[model samples]
Target: MRKEPLLLLILIALILAPSVQGAKKVVYVAKVEGTITEYTADQFQRYIDIAERNNAEALIIELNTPGGLGDAMMRIVSEIQNSSVPVIIYVYPRGAIAASAGTYIAMGSHLIAMAPATSIGACEPILGYSQNGSIVRAPEKIRNFYTAYMRSLAEESGRNTTAAVKFVTEDLSLTPEEALKAHVIEVVADDVPDLLRKANGMRTKLPVKGKGYVVLDFTDVQVRHIGNSISDVLISYLSNPAIAYILLNVGILGLIFGFLTPGWHVPETVGAILLVLGVVGLGYFGYNTAGVILIILAMIFFIAEALTPTFGLFTVAGVASFIMGSLLLFGKGGGSIYLINRETFSMLRIAIIVLAVLLGLFFLFGMTAVVRARRRKPETGKEEMIGAVGKVVEDLDPEGVVKVRGELWKAVSKTGEIIRVGETVKVTGMRGLTLIVEKAEGDAEWQE
Candidate 1:
């Protein structure tokens, strides 16, 4: 009977062990380091879903970005607003930022934190690019929509709605210290551990489906960062505007090279793939239609230059068009900073101009030289000596001399047949400046 009681106690201990381990708190962390495209939004949502499914204590997003597509930003904000688990947005590490769209995302979180030397805001919406290649702000109605949206996020998160509205209207930016003072951020932490420590015992309201609010207490949280998959990494890399722009131009160049040198399929095939991808990327980032059309026109100018001799006129036009089109590809503060900053734009313009000049030179002088080489009479060359009928000026005991084209060249008989002087022979092959001559028709058995 005592053994039975001990056995039951052991079973209870085994069963309780797992629950004890499970009681250890877990916080799902996602680090969003770049532009928040659709891909990034998906990755972020996935992390949130995982955290909710696992009953995590909280979900933390480490945000550092220059901004991204508005639609993608909205989706991320929506997911965070609807999540049952508390969402914490932290601008982490030294020298990190959460600008533009990032500011809205930060405001959407239940608890917001920032590290030293970090900043938030600059949320003025760049609605689109103007036809003249300037940044166009959202119209009154659209601007009001975002301002109201941001104000609501601030109100719900218990932040300063006035400051949030200024973020949209006046491009208000704030440092971590300033943000904390303005009640825009909840805590200013040095790092993740410091953040969790500061966040401990902090109570925040999580929105329930029908219920009023569920108070979440952040206590004894464990941070577990989610790693990005290969596809996610690739999408982030290609989302860079500079990379996309370069790929598009290189694709155009490749197609030109493939067309100039016919029968080469590799360049054209790769160019087509890259061009399609680049166009898709442009669309994904919501590039202006006018800018895209201008770029296509620039490419046409380059092709025209390659096909015809325009004395660099078409080439000049192509370079000018390329510079303008690139300038307008994405206006300042539009998408990723990597794409449309003044320095990058100027550098890319100069680089593209130089590339266009080099390609133009190749099409004009290089290809012309090749054509001339092909058409020129084969005079004074090895090919010119072939099939020439020459008189055997010296006897050939397989080694002799022949006069052809008014010049005497060292000669040998192809068949080792003896040939006397004054007999005609045909030039066959040349070895080390010596012509191999074969006996020609009507030259056989010439009377000695």
Candidate 2:
């Protein structure tokens, strides 16, 4: 009987053990689009942290970007290289690209996948702006650094180092087929489901600091898509070059309008906040000090005009200065090396011209009309006759005629005094067409 009980206990424990130890497969999918910046880096880290905390089988980054700042890219690479969970970078959705900094980030991942028609490469580094406002490549020294960095990523990821080096030097781009053939990418799939199916049980090495590599088993992992949080979406939008530029100018205009119209604290406060944010947006790429100075001078001119009403002279000057300042703002290097293109520059120039012209017209004519209305004297009525003195056209016998203000009027004497035809009379008051006159004193000349 005792032996039977022991056997029963062992059987029950064996049945329960598999259920207790089996872990569910969980894959985290993080979507990355637009220009990579500090916001992107931060959000990427957050995704990884969440995945690791959840004991995820893998973290997949869906990447589609034109590139971004070197610092932000490198930070993202570092985060990926140091992550405990395996990171799979997938260029997805049938026509996405991973260019410039995006190429660097994709290489840093444990595995890279692509959807149909997706592409990669074009890792050349654009250093900064030339004096003529065109982009220039980095120096040989910088080029070498990038070449070696890319080569390292290729070597560490077990991809083609030679081809990767060419990507930096020659700006060699690759289609999905070309990348796979060049050994730059592992595989291509139509969608996430297909990607997971293909990537399952794939062999890959994960980096562990100091210690070499930790092989991860990715067999039968269940994939799950994680949408961006509200903050993530907002940051992504704010990081857009066009949007950031608009915000910056809007802030400047708001502040100027507030200052011009005194006692409007709302616009001023909102403008201050926006200006600060705009500066921060510019900081993401980098700003030219010279450009910033020009913009400040423009603002000064605008403010001076508002305070002293230069009748659009200062306004016109300010507009001109602002256009110049805006042109030079990104002349030095910043985050997105190729962020400002020819089309963007042209659009900005046109916008500045239009805005300046509109503002000039408003201040020049609108404000003038308002001031004139406030100071104009009444042209007709009793107010016009109150202090008039004129010559008596006919002798006034308590009711005679006088010429006042170049117009004839019948006179009624205030003191019934006789006024000669050549004598001047003072208009004391008026009733209808008659002037209430008083005799002019000695040497008093009537001015009609």
Candidate 3:
């Protein structure tokens, strides 16, 4: 009977042990370094979904940025504010700064922490961009709007609204220690481990609206780190304005060159693929269906022109494609890329178009050179050497001499055939100072 009781106890203990170990808390960590783009926002949302689904104790975003697209930053902030799992924004790795748009994201989190020596703020909106380390403030209207927006975000998160407003209005900056003292950040941690230890048992508001505040216990948490994926890296790269601009130009030029030439369509094939990629890259900024269809038509025309050699037949079509692609890519018509103000976008558009025109003109000269070469006749003796007939002046045991173009030159027989002096041979090709020749099929009169 005693043995039966002991065995029952052991069975119960075994059953409960697994559950106890499995119940350990989870904390999901995502690192963000560089400009906050749409890809970054999307990836952050994905992390939030994973953390919420897994019932994580908290989702920590380790941030280090010099600021990026304002619209992307807003989307990320919105995601954080709406996430069910508590979101903590940590300005990590000493010397990192959450400046400009970064401040807004940091403020939106349920809890904000910073590493020693890190700073945050300096979010003044600029006009166009500060070229060569210069600051050009946006107009008064833009400044007022951002100032109010910053104030509201800080107020909602229970931070110093005055300081936050200064971040936008006066471009105020604060170090980690200063931010902690000003109640802008909850903790000043040296690293992730230190952050967890400092934040353990701390009370933080639930990110979801109307859910109220909850206490976060980071004790013995299982930290799962999520890194950027391959797709995210590609999207981020394509979203770059300069790269997309160069790709579009080069792709268009490749197609034009391929169409002009009559041989193997290597350029045309490469051009078509690049043009499509350029279009997709522009899609990151924003695009419409009509413009996209026109671009596709342009590509079809490119291939058609390649199949049938027509000089400048697709010029109008190619130009149309470039114009439409440029407009859709840079214009603030439907969606947003950076949420940059109208003025800044206008400047960018003009600069890109000017540079593109110069590049096109430069390549136009090259195309003209190719046309000149093709139009020149090959009827002259010097131009007609490759297919001309020659006479073997010296006996060929295989390597001998031949006379062609009114001059004797070193020659090699194609198949090592023996030929006596005075035999006629054909000049197949020229290799440096020597001629590659094969025996003439007919006893035709040689032009020696």
How do these models rank on lDDT, best leading?
Answer: 2, 1, 3
Candidate 2: tens digits of C-alpha lDDT, residues 350-390: 76577667656655675576557656877668887877789
- lDDT against the true structure, each candidate: 0.78, 0.79, 0.76
| TM-score attained by model 2 | 0.76
| Per-residue lDDT of model 3, residues 1-448, tens digit only | 8899999999999999999887889999998877667777888899899989888888999999877767888899899888888899999988898998889899888999999889999999864332232455677998888888888888887888889888888889999989989888999998888999999988774345445676888888999998788887777777666566556656876787687774979988888777777767665654355545554566555555444435646544654565565555443334233234455456656755775465444444544555676778776553477777889989877889999768888999988888779888988877777788888879655885
Which stretches of model 1 miss by more than 4 angstroms? Answer: 127-139, 205-212, 262-264, 297-321, 331-339, 377-448
1-448 in candidate 1: lDDT tens per residue?
Answer: 8799999999999999999988788988888987768877888789888988888878888899888788899999898888877888999877889998899889887789999999999998875544433656767888888999999888887789899999999999999999999988989999888888888777664363333455545576667889988877776656666677777877877787788778979898898888876776665565555566667787787678666646667766776777666666665343322234454455655766776667566656754665567668978767887778788999988999988877898899999999889888888888889999988788443222
Clashes of each: 0, 2, 0
Score candidate 1 by lDDT: 0.78
Please say which candidate is ahead in TM-score: 2 or 3: 2
Q: What is candidate 2's local distance difference test score? A: 0.79
**CA deviation > 4 Å runs, candidate 2:** 1-22, 128-135, 205-220, 333-339, 366-448
